[model samples]
Target: MILTDIVSRIYVLNLPERKDRKKEIEHALKQIGIHWQANQVICWPAIRPSSNNNFPSVGAYGCFLSHVAALQDACHAEHGWALILEDDAVFASDFNTQLPELAKVLSSEQADLIYLGHCHVASETAAPAGLNISTAAVIGAQGYLVRIAYLATLLPYLEACISRPAGHPLGGRLHYDGALSLFRQFNPSCRTWIAQPSWIEQRFSRSDIQAHWWYDRWPLLRQCAAWARKFKQARRHAATLN
Candidate 1:
């Protein structure tokens, strides 16, 4: 599949110092026939804590900011849709084939956001082929496609957070992905979904922000617990629907 034909604009978030990670992503893209361009790399800002306890950690804050930067660019760009990817994203072997199909589905449905990859913890069950739209339960901003029209609502909400002083009630409560989930809940027009059998996976790398010993030592157990929580939530949601 021709990537440019599917989505004209693609942005990858990377820190300036992480040239190695940039190179790795570029090489992987080339293997999939995507020509890596320097301009495609969005330089992530330096990590710094807010004066108050708005953000959970400097790294989380920086990660959130990087996503905002990508959204701002998408709002400014001419394309109707844009694909945003993190530098550490590992593409699946069939990414080229699957992504174009996903794009077509999103366009036909006028989807607001579709996660191309996500953590399995709290993951919802996959939708069947040809009908992939569903209310997302967990969202990992590692790789996603966003429609520019949705950014019309999203930008103002983010800008409001930007205007607030640190320690404000809403200042740092939401990470980027969390913000998206909330937006979908409050905005009746907003629609979102996850692509089943994610087309990408996050590469195992030491996080530049917050560090947790348990995540490092017992990753599988942590993921299992997450899934358990998701299943419980799903049951509750189903009961409500009935």
Candidate 2:
């Protein structure tokens, strides 16, 4: 199978603090026998926004911007679908094999986003065989796959809104929340198959000082918040199952 026919390229958007993160992830990919160099991957400089920005810009805002910028640059340079990933995410051994299959499914269905793995509503909605999707968040940056056409469509809007939440405690690169809001707004939810085993996340630092405050200062509060959200999502999924 021409892997490029399914989805042309893949990449990672890393943070400035984690300098070694990319090399490690790349090494892992090689270990898994996925030759990323043969596949297209554009590793841009990690984002370290100057303090003078309109907003604090602590989050992956610039990183997300950089991710898209790289996508545009690479696409202009080569031209095709670009799969975006984060530095800390680990892939399954079968990731390369899965890509083309997922791409075929996505194209056949015309889905806006094809989730590799994600949290979901409990209801057992039937997804296409060999793949399914939900309204849940995939540890997205782990390995987000995007359509070239879809990327072109969303790039301008993402560019426009990337700066919206900057400076806030929640701001940073890879605006998953903002992107999710935009996803639901423009495209109705569709099939995004959850990776049978979600990708593993490596330990990484959150550059946002505010993240440290919530996570470090109020550790209990952070745990509570995570538990609560997980609980709600589980409840919803259970209801669907019922």
Indicate which candidate wins on lDDT: 1
lDDT (C-alpha) at residue 180 in model 2: 47
Q: Count the backbone clashes (under 3 Å) in each candidate.
A: 0, 13
lDDT to native, each model? 0.66, 0.53
lDDT of 1 by residue, 70-171 (tens): 788777765567788888777766677675677677568568777787774254454664326666565677888888777878777776665565455554
List where candidate 2 sits over 4 angstroms from the true fold. 1-6, 15-17, 36-39, 52-57, 77-79, 93-100, 106-109, 117-130, 135-139, 163-174, 189-242
Q: lDDT per residue, candidate 2, 1-242, as tens digits?
A: 43445566766666656666667667756654545554465555556565424433455445555566766765553434566666655554455656666666656755655555343323445455345555544333455556566665656666655665453333323355346445544555433445444433332333332235455357787667656654764564455346
Model 1's alpha-carbon lDDT is 0.66
Error of 1 at 235 (Å): 32
C-alpha RMSD values across all candidates: 8.4, 8.0
lDDT of 2: 0.53
Global fold similarity of model 1 (TM-score): 0.74
Off by over 4 Å in 1: 38-53, 121-126, 129-131, 162-172, 212-242
- How many clashing pairs in candidate 2? 13
